[model samples]
Target: MRMIEIEKEQENPKMNNLRNFYERALQEFGTSDEDLWLQYIQEELGPWGQPENCGKIHWRAMKFLEGQSAESFTSKHALFQSGRL
Candidate 1:
């Protein structure tokens, strides 16, 4: 456990940078806009041939973005039904 802690401490700077990068990306792209979200993931994560797992992450992000769009649509529909919009 001590060794693991030491290793993590050594890697703390790198981890913090990565976390900040993702935080900025999420702030920019975590939205109901699917196109922007997809573009962000593709540019940040790169092509499908590299780090192949990124492709999966990209697909999952797209799916989640689609779900967000659906939810937005549902909310809009509800508003329309209630004659609120």
Candidate 2:
């Protein structure tokens, strides 16, 4: 008989919030393409193929700048405009 062990999965609250924010932003902007999200993360957020945190940062910023608070940057459209859609 062989014994099997299962590793426990850790839950990150911050990451979960960020993911929720990203999903909301995507739905708000009506962007359903994964490639477009990847491209935006690469170009607007940071360099390509760096690390998970880097990508997360992009998603966070997009969520902040494009989600609901985006109205805050209405005057500074140049900064949050691109992320809006």
Candidate 3:
């Protein structure tokens, strides 16, 4: 069962495209807002209804996005406080 799941993920083009879209959204928005992230994802998925179709993928991607955005903000804040930025 696990092997089959792995194989399915490996061969999934939609998942790959979703990841690419996440990357593009991060680059374009550069903000930590979850709504913007969801908007971008919904736009990309486009009437496919992500919550029903790709819930796990969207959840994982959102977690990664939030973490990345938080880390970036913390780093920039630290740099600014230390007179680096």
Best by lDDT: 3
Model 3 Cα lDDT, one tens digit per residue, 49-85: 3545445534544565567665654465456447685
lDDT of 1 at 79: 65
Model 1 agreement with the true structure over 1-85: per-residue lDDT tens digits: 2332343355333433443454455555554554443333343443222344445645545455556674664465356447684
Over 4 Å off in model 2, which ranges? 1-13, 32-36, 39-85
Question: 2 or 3: which has the higher TM-score?
Answer: 3
Candidate 2 lDDT tens digits, 1-85: 0110110122322434334444554555423334334433443343223355544644544564544444433333344446644
TM-score-sorted candidate list, best first: 1, 3, 2
- Where does candidate 1 clash, by residue pair? none
Worst 10 residues of 3 by lDDT: 1-10
Better of 2 and 3 by lDDT: 3
lDDT for model 2 comes to: 0.40
Model 3 gets an lDDT of 0.49
Worst 10 residues of 1 by lDDT: 41-50
